[model samples]
Target: MADRIVVAGVPVDTRHWIGGRRVASVETFTDHSPVDGQPIGEIARGGPAEAVAAVAAARDAFPAWAATPRAERARILHAIADGVDKRVEELAIVETTDNGALLRSHRRGVMPRVAHNFRFFADWLLRLDHDDFETRGHTNHVSWDPAGPCVLITPWNAPLMLATWKVAPALAAGNTVVLKPAEWSPLTASLLADIAAEAGLPAGVLNVVQGYGAEVGDALTSHPDVRRISFTGSVPTARRIAASAAANLTPLSLELGGKSPLLVFADADLELAVELAVEQYDNAGQVCLAGTRLLVEESVASEFTRRFVEKAAALTQGDPRDEGTDIGPNIHPRQLEKIDGFVQRALGAGARAVIGGRRKGGQYYEPTLLTHVA
Candidate 1:
């Protein structure tokens, strides 16, 4: 019941979202699930060449789409929000399958965040307008024009949520968009794109290009037609997009990698703190804002780490789809391998795993808690 089960009917043609239609028949790619090493879906394995074509499509659609009135755009967004509401269950299934996240997380966290996001951005459209003023000797005013078309790069950790953040704002601002979802998770993004189409959003106004970040993402950044770039991913990749965007002087919006730490003062509630800590590690630390590092007061570090390790040890692991499973496979096998390599090197250099530090299968990594990481 949670598989979206209808993914087979979803379009897989590596077509460009242009002028409110699907322009297919060129090239494509496959989308896989990290949890089981299964081919869950397919996407367009687009490259620099395709980027040129997609950007051209968006470029052509931009002026007209942007010139549309704010209220009209707002109406389209409201329609989109409505459509998303209808597809919440389906979207949640695909989301869980793609990222190996807890279904409850998607059902509760992802879907609601998406609904709130669309409506939230929909409301902003009402608040947007040009202002007029008078200077001492002459009239003075400032007006904002749509920044032409934008190419947004989203991440796998929080695909729909991150992409929605960019898509909602850009659409409300009257800018047409060309989005490249993380190769690791495109189901939700593709589904959202489908919903936008159903909502009657002009085709090229919101295009979905599913491919590698370097291939599809780079092309859009370097393409002259794309005037803005919004990327959410690793720092190295963000740096590349930023530098490339500079060539065209295209503006950028980036949410890059961060080594986040959470501090628990001695006076903090130990019970709640332990619960949240376990929850953080349960998702396999794939989330960007996850409390990857804990900076507990030295007085409580020993006791805190002990309880955290105990919780991590008891976490259930296996197929993400199982109801009783508390943990799922890492979203990417390579990512899991990377984590292993990092932890291994740290251990070789004296870091210790108080709880777990082993790879079970292709995508499943133990819910691990390492101490004294160097």
Candidate 2:
């Protein structure tokens, strides 16, 4: 890993904001730096005890927060957005180091998009109003109200930004949160918790736990006090969380992965088409919105395939921290292997490798493109 980030600032001894700052039981987990497959930091993983405690804290904080006016909540959201802007570079660095994303890339590409989400949702919340009318011969006003305490389970792909997506909206709607970031990159979540604390958020209005989903996620999902869950990840894992939430009749917002379609027409700019296909593969095609399954008009398939292969061949695969590279190593060795297998299986099934078709190292795979891929 070429980027050396400060990790000693993370809280490794205890979880905060429960029982008036009482300590909780802690176990250690080695958070790997995906750029080099090394232990970047030691995060103390919280278990059932800590999970329940965080839930209880958020639940305890919900009533007061929910009672707060919408405009007041919006004011706090503005503060959070300003807080995010103040530490954009730091968050970018921590996010890149924790998840193999290029900090500069995120700052240039993703953070701006995230800031737009916050502003859009913030405006949306303020504009939401009640409809006062007489319907069915009755007088009533239907108004939007805050959903109570919530738990957000976010993946590591865009840890800080995605958490902000949930946090900004939830806070704007006057709901308190308990976030469980993937154990791979829990440090960013802790950093957000610190920011929220400094922003003068009331104790327990926002809490974060570091741990595996099986123990911590299950505990938070099933805790009688939790009002809702919003999760993002693999469809299979989401199904499991859905099942767990069902037992409690808990409201769950699901955004499982989507297989996006990229269509290249006959008259399309070959250079632009190829550029798009290659660029979409950044993050090594790990994003839920990655335009993975391309469907080109058969008339231009051959030309498009050739151009796509040539462009993909130009992508440099190495450490994200390295400034010259356009693509980086996969987030984990297993993910690297999984993508390799996908290539191989496609090859075995007669999917022609238009460009790269081999692995470089344990964690670095080639910038590959395939055609006749099913």
Candidate 3:
């Protein structure tokens, strides 16, 4: 068995990547592997002051970067995508370790998509054309321009992918960015900073601040210099960020959490529905769009539940690094506890656990199914 995993050619001890350098903070925090609760590494603990510094760096870099021709920006973004492709395996392992996601999923699915995000944005930006319309004997030119010195706040679950979703577009659009990755999963983002630097991206074009939302996040959102704010997280936190953005009248894009429900009609294909439910339960149902609630037509409900439980029970739960493992540990102990509490409450309300319901040792929770839950 592997005792410990090291991020190849990357520092295990994560630090803020600001102005194209590894930055240290006055304080630091420990990052534990959710798989076994082992200390993986320590990361710099940034706060308001660090946020201010990152914003300043991005603000200073914005003018030169934005002035660079769009084609040139596209070239740099393509190079970044190449770098990501080269390091996909290493990045996959790093992300799996940091976020308790399956290595197989990261390697085969997420990493490729992340690389595509950069390349896609790069190509899209290159082909972009402005429109000119003649109206009332006058010409009106319409073009999409960079929003200067933007802030991107990504969540812990699928950290690198989501960060790239925001970062690639911002860079393609000619914006300098200050990214704040959730403290829980800073490893991959740090690696991404390194990759971007290696790809010859200009200094200060992309900066990452590693810390909690209350400190660094608040600072970034409210900073007067940060003209745009994009965030993906819980609803309450989104509200807080919205309020902060309001102070500067910053344009904002928010992707908040949702408990998506899957509906099954009598005419629906039972096999396909079961497959979809099984897919939903992947990632331990921790996804923001996870289909946690299921509503089925009465005629098909009983049969559907039976097959779903059988399929869910068959899913393997073990070390995420293992190829055969389907379900990995929850991101942390608190998440495990939260899942358990929710299950317990449903049971108290007279719900029946048709298959798995309790926590399976460590941070693992069994693939669970509850019926008669209102």
TM-score of each: 0.91, 0.91, 0.96
Q: What is the lDDT of residue 187 in candidate 1?
A: 71
lDDT of each: 0.78, 0.76, 0.89
Model 2 over residues 1-374: C-alpha lDDT tens digits? 11123552433332433423534344667778787788875566677888888888887888898888777777666666677677767666666777887656877877666566666677888899877889799999877677788989998788878887887788778888888888777767766776666666788888887778887788888887778899988888798888888888999998887887888888888788878777787776678888888889999988887777767666777778777777776777777878888889989999987667888875777777777765
Residues 96-200 of candidate 1: C-alpha lDDT, one tens digit per residue: 777888777777778878878878987877876667877787887777688888999898887887899999989888888888888888778767777898898
Clashes, model 1: 3
lDDT score at residue 33, model 2, on the 0-100 scale: 78
- lDDT of candidate 2 vs native? 0.76
Instruction: Report how far residue 23 has shifted in candidate 1, in Å.
Output: 3.4
Provide the clash count, candidate 3: 0
From the highest TM-score down, the ranking of the candidates is 3, 2, 1
Ranking by lDDT: 3, 1, 2
- Where model 1 places Cα greater than 4 Å from the true spot, the runs are 1-16, 129-142
lDDT per residue for candidate 3 within 1-374, as digits (tens), equals 12123653444546788887778887877888888888787678899989998999999999999999988998998899999999888899888888899999999999999999999999999889877989899999888878899999999889999999999999999999999998888888888888899999999999999888998899899999999999998889999999999988999999998887999999999999999988987888889988888999999999998889878878899999999999999998888888999999999999999888888899999888888888
